[model samples]
Target: MPNAIRRYVRFIDRTNEIVGLIMMYMIFLMIGILLYSSIMKTVAIPPLWTLEMAQFVMVTYYMVGGGWALKNDAHVRMDLIYANWQPRTKALIDTVTVLFLIFYLCLLLYGGFSSTSYALKYGETSYSAWSPYMAPVKIIMCFGIALTLLQAVAQLFKDIAIARGEEIS
Candidate 1:
């Protein structure tokens, strides 16, 4: 592989790694919040922010972790047939599927951007008691989807190279 492409792929990988770490910390924080809230409930102190913040953190976790999962090839697939295919055949199938995925992701990215824009313009906030601004979570979601699309492109390049008899080490 050329140095530039290799570096780009490495950058994507690193981005996913960092995102995954952030997600992990977010999950830990969510757990702590829930535990504290549970303990506080025994004393008749209602922690409304705990539920709202937990929901936000959960959304961020799923969105960011999705990209990391894609980077790791951990997305769901039909293993019954795909596992039996030869490597070249698998590569071809993956390349073709990736093309469709790119199209889908393009649409998703456009829609996400539009929705995020609307949220920012309207100062959208949750309907809960906390009613925090929604723009930040929407922005994070769009960013995660964009990163996942980038990882898909990288995977397409690898699949094409593999189809062309290039050794990937």
Candidate 2:
């Protein structure tokens, strides 16, 4: 890989690493919030926003965490078959799948961004009693999808390089 492309890849990888760390810590935060909510409920002082807040946080965690998972190659797959493939064959299969994923994620990103824009334009909010504005969450969802798409593109490049016997690292 050229220095510039390699640098861009490194930057993306590092950014996703930070995102993954945030997601990891958010897991702890979610657990703490839920536990506190449960304890408070036992004492008859249940927080009305606890469930809704948890849902938002959990969704954000999953959204932003997805790209990190892909970066680490942690997403589940049919390893029984994949592990038996040759290197070029593996690259080919990954190329096909990543192309499909890129298309799907592009659509998702468009939808997410459009919904977020609409929510902001119209002041959309959750119907729950807490009634948090939907725009922020939608924006975050879009950001996550964008990151996932970026990672998918980077992976596609690498897969292509491998298939062509070109050096990537």
Tell me how many clashing residue pairs each candidate has: 0, 0
How many clashes would you count in candidate 2? 0
TM-score of each: 0.92, 0.94
Q: Which candidate tops TM-score? A: 2
Q: What is the C-alpha lDDT of each candidate?
A: 0.85, 0.88
**Candidate 2 error regions (>4 Å):** none
Candidate 2 residue pairs in clash (backbone atoms < 3 Å): none
What is candidate 2's TM-score against the reference?
Answer: 0.94
Scored by lDDT, model 1 comes in at: 0.85
In model 2, the worst 10-residue window by lDDT is 1-10
Of candidate 1, the 10-residue stretch with the lowest lDDT total is: 160-169
lDDT against true structure, model 2? 0.88
